[model samples]
Target: MMTSRRDFLASAALLAAGLAVGPPLLAAPPKKYLGVQLYTVREAMEKDPAGTLARLASIGYNAVEGATYTGSQKFYGLTPSEFAALLKQNGLLMPSSHYRLGEEPTNGAPTLGTLLHGWDRAVDDAAAVGAKYMVCAYLAPAERGTLDHYKYVADQLNRAGERCQQAGLQLCYHNHDFEFVPQAGQRPFDLLLATDEKLVQLELDLYWATKAGQDPVALFRQHPGRFPLWHVKDMAKTPERAFTEVGNGVIDFKKIFAQAKQAGLHYFFVEQDTTPGSPFDSLTQSLAYIKKNLV
Candidate 1:
């Protein structure tokens, strides 16, 4: 998505008028594809996976990310192959899936062979659905209570990355605002980033990063290409700062989307943890805003 000088000039009118300068206008060639994390519509998906997916495709989503696959190694009760076919039928790709990787002590961690054939079929199933990246979605407060625990997690993630790579996938870590808090005057977030650079990629959540008072662009500058995915959620205007649809909130998405290349964005998924009404409706509103103003 290069912003050639000509395209930049063409978009100058919008910029001068202070209109939303979405990527489609400022950049050249093939418009960016957008995906939504299915968790945003978990209830609907849980009740009717097929119908939910069909609706998403119609709403202009070219891709999706799975948030859960916990029941019987099946994605929402469908086998990996079935899930892949469903995505294909909807004209979508599940390039990534959220999976919980144990940050256990390496000494007690699964052996390489165990990882391949053990009861923990996360990596295998994720691969089966054609996912190229497996992201650890959350770390319970108990799991990250201390620096040593985080270091142990880093070690485990490094080991897990090796296993994922063997399965033709990359392992990544997703974050919330909690990671930004300082521990003993040193941020554990830094320790995680300081881990095996090649082994650990980041799925940067823009809303959480901003809520934590950290600049998303600065993080990109600090660690180029380390972020391959993002959770493009927005915060409501209330003092509680609840989750809201993309353009409805106060986030400067247009500014941030402009830095996609430096952030090494392969794909980003719109994910609003809470919504005023139907998740599909929220998705529709977010998609419209993104297409016209952020891409």
Candidate 2:
């Protein structure tokens, strides 16, 4: 089976070319899409909800997490139908929304007569907007301050989560630095996670988690697949804890993003609670950087 010189050289050249190009061809990287939390542009949203959404879409945001609906139902304003239409017109998808869990006493609890009247309406509106998640973005004063209080809050979250689940939506809790405070030897954040793995999930705010002196990677390691959403914001190097554009600050997003699979991340929204410049400019820059580097 000895080959001639010409045939042997040709076969060797073909084999070398295939080996050089095969690895890249076989390894197709995953696509990383970007989204925005509307709350980041609260001021602009207040002025014109539709216009603000349009601007966000134009800036390369394909998905949006609603802060409020500013239309007819006044379920913050935009009725589910109207809001859905608005998003459709602008080529955006509404995958999640922030809603205050358990109304304030002044606003009346779910047991109150006025509140009872609209339970179905709330569920209907959420469905209409195509929101898969309804996040409890904050806690009431009575709900915080101690370990016992957080445990109680966690129970309420479980109950609410059951309701959300019935409506084909998942319930999530968004964190701020306060949740990181330790109480009676256990972190409130840990207590919340321990509440009910099935009933409660986390939407980790990377900036706040870092600000609270906790490592985001450690939390991810401690509870794999518990975090479904992430607020990808950067923290300034200053002592005041200022909000900086994504790539301009000290947070290492690339490292955090690498754990997306273990964290069960479904969406990562860019949120700068207070941008050094205009919120729009800040988010635009953040998105550009994420696309260029983190993705």
Query: Which candidate's lDDT is highest?
Result: 1
lDDT agreement with native, every candidate: 0.75, 0.71
Judged by whole-model lDDT over C-alpha atoms, candidate 2 comes out at 0.71
Q: Candidate 1's residue-wise lDDT over 108-214, tens digit each?
A: 65322122223247788888898888777776454677888788877877887887888888888888887889989988889889878778899888888899999
Pairs that collide, model 1: 22-293
RMSD of each: 9.7, 14.4
Query: In model 1, what lDDT does residue 84 have?
Result: 94
